[model samples]
Target chain A: MIDWSIIAEALPAFAEGLKTTMMLLAISCGAGLVLSVPLAVARVSPHRAVWGPVWLFTYVMRGTPLLVQLFMVYHGLAQFEAVRESFAWPALRSPWFCAWLVFTLNTTAYTTEIFAGALRATPSGELEAARSLGMSEATIYRRILLPSALRRALPQYGNEVVMMMHATAIASTVTLVEITRVARDVYYNHFAPLESFGVVAVIYFVLTFGMAGLFKLVERRALRHLRPTASGVA
Target chain B: MLHGYLPAILGGLQSTLAVAATSLAIACVFGILGAAAKLSASRAARTVAGVYTTIIRGVPDLVLMLLIFYGGQIAINRLADAAGWGYVDINPFIAGTATLGFIFGAFLTETFRGAILAIPRGQMEAGQAFGLSRGQVMRRITLPQMVRHAIPGFTNSWLVMLKASALVSIIGLDDMVHRASLASAATRQPFTFYAAVALIYLALTTISILGLRWVEARYSLGVRKVEFK
Candidate 1:
């Protein structure tokens, strides 16, 4: 039988670590969206010039491992004295910032594809209607295009968000002290794998479950018009 | 510098590939067994399969790698001392491979189980009616179909397994990442070493993605006829 005392002992530290994990998730996902929005639009550019580099950027980021990418920015960027002297040095100097930056770029690659796919899948009739109404490009994007594209992308985007939460566990590689890091510390201190990892496992499960539930809520809200009344009530 | 770079990275690549190959083979074998156990009627089998997947899946690869490698070392040293084996030292490479293989086996278990379930029940029934032995039926009909069904999920997991292989560096394995870390530390040209590592990983993944897609197409060859709708 597993001892409950170990869990009780680890709870406070785990909670603090959970806060940092959430911070990483929030910043990465937020920054990812900001970066992806332009990239998505650029990817669908009618001209090859805009689309080519955007696609390559997404591909390279998507193709590589997050840990390697984080290390590249964190340790790699410091190699260049020019980069060290550059205005961006201070931002890159911080491990936390580098972790977030790497994660942001990684998530951006995934989100750009998701959002771009959503944009392409937006109803042709709707686009035709928007143009027929003489709506400007900005107005069409703001008023009609993005909203429907977002609605279509909500479920996939939710899945991506949950995956990111799990991926952030790797942030500890850069010494972020997230939930996984705390678990490692506990394991080192007590030399008890089952007890330490068990606590961390529970925290991860709870977070994953909570994120899934939140995604469900967002999905329902996005598809409210499409859902049956009985479905909504339930 | 450029002359030495490719050769050193290539040596790391060979080692990384060797580890990945061994682990992937082990993972697939376990995947089959676990998937079969998951679909077994025995409650014990189901429980074991479920627990194996849940615990591994919930934990990240790096954490699992550390725990298993360190824990195994401690456990083995104790056993060796008690048995007078005279100070056995476990290799980091073996530990890293075992960790990746074990964790991925859990994932592949689910993929294989889901694939087996998706097979039409009537096909198995038809095999039984033809007076085929259970083994014969499984070999000819069930296993092949399951492989086809398992391909897509297997591909995704395989790609992921490659990336997860990077964690071996932390355990002091002289894979590409470890070599890069050392190279950067020795040269103080962190950008050059890590950028080289990242590019190598990207190259491997791009090639892997294409290869997996080809395998998927191969497995999916005869099964594309029927539409679900």
Candidate 2:
């Protein structure tokens, strides 16, 4: 029932699509990670001024659909005369830049919440010990809080990564030739759903499980301390 | 400002809600069956449910929708050709809801399974001692309590499903997103129209959260919390 020749012909396209997908995933995730740490720290701040705006930002972001966010950045911004005349308009015009900007912000909003939750869940005793040691606020945060919270956030953050990866498929709507876009093209050309979407489904399956397994390994190492001992005490 | 298309965009909310509500119902049906299968005595049922959840969860929703939409159309037409029937056009509404329901069903299966498992096994045995039938035990003893445990996960799935309904526009369903695009194209105010739609979505999300919280509280009325000092 399946046609091998069509998939064979589409292999080259899928490879290029895979490259685009990986690039989008790597850039957005790396940028999101860097941006989310400080945002998360600010998110947990005692001062309303520090945390309030961050709360609003994450709430708005998490509330709306990512596709709408993408449209606002991409098709929405171009409608402005000022944005068109601005120097940054050139960067804004590229689909790559728009995708990167949206995906990073989207993932950052989610990661910030995850990391902030993890930071909130940090053991009080750990903080007390750090403070009693005369550690500076910055030092305590840098050395103790961030490390433990990040280790705790690893699994959730891993889910965000996989989610963002899957989300890159939406980049196709804006004309980015990611895996989903490639699959769509293949489908339009051959009218073979089994050969086109079926193949892409397998590719995404591998990507999803690959990400899950990678996170499992990371959690094993990072959470080794929490693992049960030989006597069954955690 | 929605540039005189406010009503048009707002009207699309009907379609959006319809899609979300229909898909949610379908998802619940699939979810219960999947949960039952997983908890069944037969190993084959468990394996089938396992594969269903695994494959469905692993794929992207958009890909699945497109697959079932276009792929299903072709498959049905082929069957029709064999039966000497005419062409069948699959409605985007039907296709979108089916795909969303199918995809989210996998997630809810896990949620439902976990919720059911959270109940004490002794309760079931106690019901047996009381001479309640297995189905009676399920209905009277297990399901009601499961609702409390299931609420948090159900709320999450609903929120995700609500947002996911926006994707139906991609398959040509005239959801709010699609209406925004049309308005944007007409008025040349893409930002304003999309922002309006975004705000509407945010409102829906906030309202859903509050509503679900009330539901959760209602369900948990019988449960007592133990606090650790």
Candidate 3:
């Protein structure tokens, strides 16, 4: 029932869509990783003054749906005459910018929480030892806490990256023509849902597994010290 | 304009809730079956359950929703034609709920399986040794404790599913998100409607958090709280 010729014809569009999808994923995830470190540090601050607004930001972002958040950025913001008149309007009007902004913000909130949880769970004895060794608070954070927390956060962070890749599909709704949009276009044009979506499914499956495998390699390298040695296993 | 559109969006909230509730029910059924298959001794059951969870977890929900809603409709029509049944139309509600249920069922299967595994095996063996039948041992010993262990993961899945219900709007389900879009178009105030919908979602998630906390507390009644530094 599947037509090979239709898929062959649609291959170029699919390739273009895949590029857009990867670009969106890379930009959003890159921004999210950069932004989340400081946000996560702020999240675990002892003083409410430092953490309260950060908490509220992550809470609000996490509480709502990503699609609605995307809408608020892509479609909602333009509703305001002031926003339209603002200097940011040019960038805001572009669907790619809005999708990137929304995704980066969303993933940052989630990754911040993940990193914050890891930070909080850092063994206090290590911090106490650092203190007794005359390590400054900043030194302790930079040397001991952030490194360990980040290492611990790798698995969840990897999952978040995969999720962000999947989430880029939503960009299609705002006319960004990502993988899902290409599949839909193919389906409409060729009247073959199976061939159209089936191809996209295989693409996504490969991407997802490829990402998982990459993260697994990272884990093995970064976490090699934590692994039990062959001699120690006995 | 916000006041005028409030009732219409609220009506859509009803549809959204209905879809969420129905999908949760279906997901529970699929979860139980999946968990059973995973935990069973049968090789085929285990392999099938493993594959179901892996594929569902790997793909985006939107892709799966579109695939099932569109492809399932076409597949059904083909089957009907072959059977001389004329034509078949698939309801978006069924397609949406089934897809969400099927998708989240994989998550729930892991949750339930982990919960079951968390139960001490000795308890089940002791129950059996006390002359309790296998069914009685499961019902009396395994199930009750599994509820306590499962609550947290179940809550997580439920919250995720609640947000995911919004995706159904893309499949022409007339959910709150869809309504908000329509209202945005009509009122020419996308921010107002979308913000309203976001607030509604926040309210739902907040209430669910509170409710699940209560359930967790009720189930943890006899357990000691661990104080960790």
Pick the winner on TM-score between candidates 1 and 3.
3
lDDT of 3 by residue, A114-151 (tens): 99999998988989999999999899989999999999
- TM-score of every model? 0.87, 0.98, 0.98
In angstroms, what RMSD does candidate 1 have relative to the true structure?
A: 3.6
lDDT of candidate 1 over A16-50, digit per residue (tens): 99999999999999999888887888898898999
- Scoring the B chain of model 3 against the true B chain gives a TM-score of 0.97
Q: Which tens-of-lDDT digit does each residue in B1-229 have in candidate 3?
A: 4859888999999999999999999999989999999999999999999999999888999999999999999999999999999989999999999999999999999999999999999999999999999999989999888999999999999999999999999999999999999988998989989999999999999999999999889988999999875
DockQ of each: 0.54, 0.85, 0.86
**Candidate 3 Cα outliers beyond 4 Å, as residue runs:** none
Ranking by DockQ: 3, 2, 1
Per-residue lDDT, model 3, residue A140, is 90
* TM-score winner between candidates 1 and 2: 2
lDDT of 3 at B40: 98
Ranked candidates (lDDT, high to low): 2, 3, 1
